[model samples]
Target: EGIENTNYFVQTSKKKVILTIFENRVKKSAIPKFMEILIFCSKNRIKCPKPLADSKGKFINEIENKKYGIFSFLDGKSKNNWNKRDCFLVGKTLANLHNKNLRRSFKLVNNLGILSLKVLYNKLKHKINGLIPNASKPISDEIKFLTKEWPRCLPKGLIHADLFPDNVLFNEDSISGILDFYFSCHEILAYDLAITLNAWSFFDGQFKKEFFNEIFKGYETKRKLNKLEKDKINLLLRGASMRFLLTRLYDMVYVSENELLEKKNPIEFYKILKFHQNLENINDYIK
Candidate 1:
């Protein structure tokens, strides 16, 4: 179900667990930081994977030059499509995640941030003209616009940068778990909201206004976004769209085949990027 790592369900006599073999994209040194996040979440009463340590008190293990870890399996299923309540719950959960107070400052660089996006764009710039036809110029132009317009000095925090539908698990009406924190990083808090908005508020190549409004409704209950966050959200939305578009395009162009992974369509976000590009005012995004 996960795109970045090889995962398996291991059912022992006592309990069930998830065994994850870290893929090449995962950095071995960063595995501990990921565990720290899970531990932190568990301590805060948030439902997430808990890393199981070995007999030697080590969280990460190595086998055949590959790093691996075992995590206590979550007990809910992910939804392919979500209703307004689901959107509200996910939005509230994300806001709760951002509102936590870390005892000490943590720094984990976002490998998929703005500069990295540009590097990936340049790598695939020539190839895109052949595949998508006339997409190169718009993407390149967006790259410059986003890089220049990206805001700084907004609210910053630890965020689940990739909170897509498949990453959240639901049990009946309540959210039971939040999965896939490998893309988590210290970034703009509103940017995390933008990523969530992009992921959950679009379907069948169109944006849903009701879904977007409910998300804001639920999120404000926990942590309120300032006026600046509201004003700059469209730009952040564009950034989020471009980020996923470039990554999906990279998977489409590069040959890194794995039976466990499925390549997502970049065109889904291409349309989304176009929507943001043609926006007349910030009110179009909100009521």
Candidate 2:
């Protein structure tokens, strides 16, 4: 279901859970912090998986020289086609996560932040261009512009950072689970919103303003964006697109095709980035 970690569903007479094997550049040192995040989310009443400890009271352990963890499997499934209510629910849930006092608990550095994006783009630049001829220059130009203009100091907190639809599972109308916190880190709260907006506000390669408005409305119910955050939304959206674009590009260029994982097309975010770049009035988009 995911490109990063190898996951298997294990069902027993007592319960069903997920067994995740760390893979595809997942750092061994960061596993504990990821478990800590799940604990924090559970404490805050955010529906997410809680890591299960073994007889030795360890949440993470080794198998075949690789770190692994078992998580309480969530009850619902992710939807491919989201309705308006789905958009609103996801937005509200994300805001609920952001509003929690997370930094006081712990801090996890974002491995895929702007600088990391630049680094990854540099690594994959030539390969990506090979895949899409004459693509390198425009991507490099976008990366430079984003690095120079990246926003700072709007609001900082723990963010899921990767809340694409497949990462979220629904039990009918409400979000039953928010999965894949591997990219979860402390970052600008509004940047997280921007990432989510870019992920959930599109349908069949087209941006839907109605869906965007509903998500914004739902998010405002819990946490209102400051003027600065509002002003930076478009830029953050572009940055978010760049982040995914590069990461997906890296995976596409390097990682081998696996039956268990479905590789996302980087061109999806490329189109998204172009859309934000061509916007005439940002104010009209958000409000």
Candidate 3:
């Protein structure tokens, strides 16, 4: 089956293997980077699909104008809808991932957290200025607030910055495997949690109390957040929401003409920011 550019499937033979093929769009330099991260995760005892080496003992193989690799096929099903238990388990897994001691370290060239929004704003700011008065001001204010608040709240570490539902696999009530380390990097662990919370707890841009509680509860079980971290959660949530909203908005406006990638609704995340604005205080959830 195809999910975006990556193709995944199980082998039919007696020796079953999970195959992942990436198109030419995946850069050659990034192949080794991806392998290193996966190997590090495996060595650190993280539950991910184990990479299978070829005859020469290479974990990755380039073939047929694409990058091909095999992993141990994990037996599980992806949930179409998420529940509190699922969200909690996923949250716990993400926390554990951030805590892993990796053998090798990687440096990020672009701040993926801010990249989407920066790109979107630069592309549309001129047009949006005339079309939607005061649109630019709110975005600028939010960016300035995040820039000042994010660094003060927490330092950086190994983080699974993108924890979307599709990246997690659930077997029964537990998280069996965590896949797709493409967006993984060294960043604030709280930001990772914030990203997960933004995706897991928010539905069409609104916070679902049950879901948020479950995710927060699960994360707290692994590692408790300090007062500063707790306060930063709301700010990070806003930043993360803006990141997705701006990217979706740009894609909706500029790239929607493209037939390949489906456009996401930018309005959903816009609603999420409004919901956060209505919160009387971030401390209410910490208790």
Top candidate on TM-score is 1
The segments of candidate 2 whose C-alpha lies over 4 angstroms from its true place after superposition are: 1-3, 103-105, 258-261, 280-282
lDDT of residue 45 for candidate 3: 81
Error of 3 at 201 (Å): 0.7
TM-score order of candidates, best first?
A: 1, 2, 3
Which residue pairs collide in model 1, if any?
Answer: none
Q: In candidate 1, what are the lDDT values of residues 1-287, reduced to their tens digit?
A: 45578889999999999999987777888888989998888889888889999899998999999999999998888888789999998889999998883343458888899878889998999888776679999999999999998898898878889999888889889999988889888888888998999998997777998888888888999988898988888899999999999988888888566444578988888889999888844589777
**Residue pairs clashing, model 2:** none
For residues 1-287, write the lDDT of model 2, one tens digit per residue. Answer: 45468889999899999998987577898888989889878887988988998899999999889999998889899998999999999889999998885445458888889888778877987798777668888999988888898887778988989898988998888889988888888889988999999999989999999888888889999999988888888889999999988888877877776534567888899899989998734476865
lDDT of 3 by residue, 1-287 (tens): 22334655776657778788765434666767777778888888888878889899988887786778888777677776889899889878877776674334577533457644565577877655454455677776776766665554385677776677877887888888887776666677787888888888866545677888888888888878788777667777887778776766666667645445556676677677666655634664544
RMSD of each: 1.4, 1.7, 3.2
TM-scores, all candidates, are 0.96, 0.94, 0.84
Best by lDDT: 1
Instruction: Identify the superior model by TM-score, candidate 1 or candidate 2.
Output: 1
lDDT of 2 at 271: 92
As a whole number from 0 to 100, the lDDT of residue 126 in candidate 1 is 86
**lDDT (0 to 1) per candidate:** 0.86, 0.86, 0.71
Q: Candidate 1: lDDT of 183?
A: 88
